[model samples]
Target chain A: MSIHTLEVLVENEPGVLARVSGLFARRAYNIDTLVVGPTSNPEVSKMVIQVNLEGHSLEQVIAQLDKLISVISIEELVEGAKKPVKDTQPDYQN
Target chain B: MATTHVPTANGTVMNGATSLVKSLEAAHVDVMFGLPGGAILPAYDPIFDSTIRHILVRHEQGAGHAATGYAQVTGRAGVCIATSGPGATNLVTPLMDAGMDSVPLVAITGQVPSAAIGTDAFQEADIRGITMPFTKHNFLVTKADDIPRAIAEAFHIATSGRPGPVLVDIAKDALQTQTTFNWPAKIELAGYNPKIVPDNQSISDAAALIAQSKKPVFYVGGGVIKANAHKELAQLVELLGAPVVTTLMARGAFPDSHPLHLGMPGMHGTVAAVTALQKADLLITLGARFDDRVTGKLSTFAVNAKVIHADIDPAEINKNKFADVPVIGDLRETITALIPALKSALAKNSQDLAPWNASMQKLKSTYPLGYTLPDDGSLSPQAVIERIGKISGTETIFTAGVGQHQMWASQFISYEHPRTWLNSGGAGTMGYGVPAAMGAKVGAPDSTVWAIDGDGCFQMTNQELVTCALNNIPIKVAIINNESLGMVRQWQTLFYEGRYSNTSLESKRVPNFPMLAEAMGCVGLSCERPEDLDATIEKAMSINDQPVVVDFRVHRDAMVWPMVAAGTSNDEIMIARATAPDWDSQEL
Candidate 1:
């Protein structure tokens, strides 16, 4: 099993993060690295969620991510894209 | 000539009040319950016109508890707002309640202006520092620019991992600041990320043990309820064919009607559940931390069983009992993973429950939650609880404080649905019932709410009674008045050689609760004997204009049945001595 990094673009609003985090939380997704920052567009922000998965669990994560209404775009940043950056190391769990 | 850079006093670029609303809206705070005050006037001014519904609470504590109730019921962070000094201090009770119960809540307060912060200015208090230990995290935002981040941080700290309450303080000047506000809906907290899955090997090992064990039991906790994994828990338990013993918080996670459900297992647990745990070969604990009340003198707890503990919080994993297998992950994920693994393991082997099932049934008939309800006059706490339960029925929401009353309520009440019964389980805060009941009412405004409490426990925060009256929150307060600290007395009689010192409140100068209720502008009823109990409670519960408090003068020495005496194993619970009825069993 390896950790996968996912970049998610979402609408900027209150509870958007809670909904996303709660989705991962309720589904039992082990979030490792989550980075959210305002993009050039004021009404949208990019969230990078890193989670470890066994086998095909990453597919489930991607599918779940698409279900959130606030999520505009999601791309897996593991293996090929950005090739496993050390800075993406998992930080502390809140 | 005056170039002191005062930032234009009140009309500066940052209006701390508006910023708070924008930040709260950014945090997706749907509603906020609070009472307006002089110190928090700036914040209220904007809230009056904001999209976020602001409820005017009777007391600051009520606001806090309402948020707690909302959070507990909805599994989202409940939000409340209050002013400085007295208002902030009042929010403490509910904040502490939420913290103790592991409910996610966000409490925002308006502090005195920065210039008047520590001078005890008419409504000035250091709420941030005072609430530090009791909260998951707290922040005192001095700069107006930090208002959004502070609120965002509070919400993050409150709802993430090991959920609890968080407090944010905004100075009056900060609320009045006028600044460029772009509410960022999402946040990236650097120091906060809760683990949601266990190491694969630990999960494999736990699954293996469950497969090999002949007799196994699953101990569930509030974590299962909070994680919304009740169905998953049931699935796993069914897969393993194990009996479940729930902590106070975990009630309703496993249907009590299930053949394998053993009800609550702890200081006041059932004999069947406790005995099942004692005789098990392996204990698969999910979302439950080993609380002392559940595992008396840890050394003797489940001596025959090896523990496979799974919890979301890492600190709780090996804190109490050593685990043969420790799984740190969200309960839903852990259970989801265990189900498939256990199914695979069980496919290779088979076991029968005939022997284990027979033993549990024997314990149930031996020491059921039984008590004789007298037809005559002397009041029994059990009878009082039974009557209340009968009236509330299965659909009503019941909340209790920590005391003999709480135990009695847990015993007598039949909770059919999950989250219907709320209480301060682990923290054991005495004055929690009323506030919590009030909170539950706010959560389900149309549902019947009953706050059951003991005389000793009620007085701890009886002040909230006023909050109920002022808010017209019609919750029935059932006071099991033995006129003494019943739990302590029972402990003294059972363990400490019967040295009932300082247990009796007979001589202590306490206010007349009924009269106090009247003074607080609520209806009060007192029942000195069993004959008046039924009608009195019915009348009290019927009141719709204001809250009602009923003091039921119960038997002083009455103890909650099936109690596991301290330092003793759960198997050795003391049943409600079925022999004596105290002679006054029927009369006043």
Candidate 2:
């Protein structure tokens, strides 16, 4: 098993967070770490989800998440990019 | 001069309730099923003068299942409405049921005012949160302005590729506020794009596999029915002259009378079908996921088979069994493309399937589906179902509750057309037959619809008889009354040493099914002797003004045979309690 991170952009609305997180649980996909924050356009939210899976499961999860109405686009970040300097991670000051 | 006809959806300024009604009208909604309560009261105000006919159901669950039934048969988005909290929560079962079976349904529920959402207000429940995992998509409309768009999107998402349930929960305040209604030019779903065309390479690869393999089986599922692709599927099946095994959800996808049809596969499936899958070398699976029930002991399931899986949903292709040649596209399109490709591939290499056909014929002749009469002399439930289907003929639509009756209905009924056989397959929910049958009758007013239910399943939603009686649905219900939870009791007899515990519902006359039917304003008839069975069913068929119920008190000892015990390999299938069919392949 290896680590993979999916950057999903979704509409900022009621139950948007629940829709994304609940999808993972429903499909029985386990998440190692998840971080959500507002984009420059306050109307859109970005969620970074990291999961440990092997074979085509990561591809399957992305395909499933893409079916949701709230989701706009999904991008897979490079594997090693996950461990940026500890302080360079997204800050929740706002 | 030519006129460009863009459908006009502009509407005058109105409250969200009227907006909701007008939006549904703009969507060309013919009928809806629902119940009204506190938070949903405003949405009901505009129904008095609306063109949409709303069937007032007895319960919210009934409304949900009724909508599901309507969607399954009609291939349209079924609409159901309910209030907040208890009403919304009650819809949980049918939502998940429709999700599993891939029915297109739109559920509209009212929520407490926006201000009271998280304050634990009376009649407040987070229904969107509860149903997210099951429904295909959902919307929580916090503003009245969002009503039209949300409703339009809900219908679009529900009926599109890989159709499933979608929910829209609007706040009461939103329904009371004023807004202008206008349908969007196009749905604004960015991430939702379903690929319909198959890649040429994939199609050619699948076609070559089919041409080269000696033993091939088309494992069809409900998607064939949903996509309206049975014609293409039948073409492919006949071209190869190979065996076909339709899953329970796909009973009518292929003609049951076809020369090469081997009935349904999985637990309680026919011996011929189970054996075809076990010994096959190529499985040309279409629109079917390798479900656990269908794949008894997956490791041993089709040990020699290589799957050529095709589905609209990519996630399903390799979720359970690995697909050697995965064709990710709509089944209708995929099959259409593969037909020509197969013809070309066969020009180069044509493998003879005579050896495989010999094996299938041996299994079919040796282990035909038949049940001996129970010692108690009560009517055999299987015989009762066959008689019901035989009398009703191929034109009629049949629905069943889950249990022995469901299995019997699948096995005995001669389904000739798509959508003729409707039942809860993936999610085996009891109490689904009556309401779904009622919905089917409403959708097809001229067609005869029958709900073959078991004694255990009938009592759960039998109250819906009042809905049918009050309306002019005129549905026929055949209660396979065994006076016990027949399926469970059968398992207890086999696995639990015949120690029947809490299995018997006790006192056949306690509820008095006939009396209950009469009280519900239906013609209640009971038949105990097999001699009177035909006449009683014929008598029930004669009535065309009101719903009729015939309680066939069957032998309690009857069990579904040609069985594969839970988690056991298909090789261990039992034709009877202790009898196993010896296959010709066993000698090979």
Candidate 3:
């Protein structure tokens, strides 16, 4: 399993976090750390999820996450979280 | 907008419940199955006066399964409703069933007041939280105005893409709160776009592989049925002239009687079909996920076959077996494109499939499906099921509960059309047959629908017969009464040294199926002898005014053959007791 981080942008709606994390729990994918909070846009939320999985399984996870209606887009944090998170976003764990 | 005073063009401002009814009407929902409780009572008020027919089922599980059945037959989202807490929780099985089988289902549930939510108040449950993993998508409606949008989106999500269950849990307070009603609500799903068109490159690659391969098999699965790609699949089959094998969930996706058909594959599949896959050089996997049941000991299955896996769901591709050419998109469009590409490829350099065709024909004709009569000389479940199919013809929609009877129904029946067979394939839910058959009848009133159930499975959700009787659904039910959980008993005998344990249902007579059927206001019949089989079946078929139940007291010793034990390789299939078919000649 390789460590990888993803930045997912989703709608600032109820149960959006559950929808994201619940997918991992159900599909038996591994998660290292996940943080979710409000973004610059009030209507959107930002999630930085770190997972320890194979490269292909990561793609599968991302593809499944992309299927959630609330999720707008996802980007792999290629540089690996040079900064933990933006100051404007709250420190939330899920 | 929350409007208590303002009036719309149609009438006075309505509550969330009334708005939901109007939205459902707009969605063209002619029938819905549901039950009412405290939180859902407010919604029942508007439904009382609406044009949409509400089918009151005895249980919420029935409502959910009924919706799935309706969706499977109608190719539309089946709608079900229930109250909060227990009522909503009861629908969990059906949600999982729809999720497993990719049936389009819209489930509307009542939640505790938004204020009472997360408080463990009376009848309060986080239905949205409970079902988040099972549903394609879900919404917890707090604002009264969100009801219409949620309904619209739920309908859209449930019926689109891969077509699975969607949940819209409405807060009780929202339903009671006054809200402006709107029609043609906008769907705002930003990240839910499913790819309908495949890349031309992948299509061309798949075509090239198919054209050059001497031994190729069309490994069909349930996605073909969900995608409604039978016409395109037929066209592709005619173009390639390859042997086709449909999976359990895909039993009716391809015509069973087609000249190149190899029957079903995997565990409990036909010898020819399984061998063809075991020996194939290329597998043209179309809309079929390589399910564990179909690909027993995945490493050993189709080991020689180069894969051309095509599916609408991206996750399914390469999830199990590696896809040599992964075609990701809606299968109808993918196959539609591949047909022409394959034609051009065939025009270039087509492999001589004559040798492969001869081998497959030899396999199919040599090891045709057959079963021996029991020593006690009772009715055979296979014969009864086959006769049911033969008499009713392909026009009849057949649904089965999970067990030996389900296997018999899948194997015995000849399916020549799509959407003609429905079963709890992925979830393998035991009580799926009766309610799904009821739903199928509601969706297709002109055709005959039969629920072929085992005695063990039938008892789980048989209470829905009362709903069928009251609603004028004339679906027939045939209970293959083997007197026990026959599948379990078979495993016990095979693996557990015949210790039996708790696998006895006391076959002689417990709760007489015929009497129970009559009690439920259905025309009940029982057939114990072979001579009475046709007469009883014909009688069941003739009854068109009310629901009918016929219990065929089949021999309890019967077991499903062509067995590949769980986690074993498909190469080790047993055609019958102590018999493995000759596989030496399968050079392909």
Could you tell me which residue pairs clash in candidate 3? none
Compared with the true structure, what per-residue lDDT tens digits does model 2 show for residues B1-588?
A: 111122354667889998888878866789999999999899899987898999999998889888988888899999999999999999999999999999999999999999999999998999999999889998899888998888888888888778999999999999999887766666756667666777888899999999989999999999999989999999998788899999999989999999799889999999989989988999999999999999999999998999999888866867789888988787899999999999999989999988888778777776778889988777889999999999989999999999989999999999999998989999999999999999888888889999999888898998889999998889999999888888899889889999999979752777888889999999999999999999999999999899999989888888899899989998899988987876544532
Off by more than 4 A, model 2: A79-94, B1-11, B584-588
User: Individual DockQ of the candidates?
Assistant: 0.06, 0.29, 0.33
Question: Sorted on lDDT, highest at the top, how do the candidates line up?
Answer: 3, 2, 1
lDDT of 1 at B348: 79
lDDT of 3: 0.88
Docking class of 3: acceptable
True contacts kept of 2: 0.50
List, in the given order, the native-contact fraction of each candidate: 0.10, 0.50, 0.52
**How close to the true structure is residue B420 of candidate 2, measured as C-alpha lDDT?**
89
TM-score of chain B of each: 0.88, 0.98, 0.97
Model 2's alpha-carbon lDDT is: 0.87
Better of 1 and 2 by TM-score: 2
Off by over 4 Å in 3: A80-94, B1-12
Local accuracy by lDDT, each model: 0.75, 0.87, 0.88
The DockQ-based order of candidates, best leading, equals: 3, 2, 1
TM-score, each model?
Answer: 0.78, 0.95, 0.96
- Give candidate 3's error at residue B172 in angstroms: 0.7
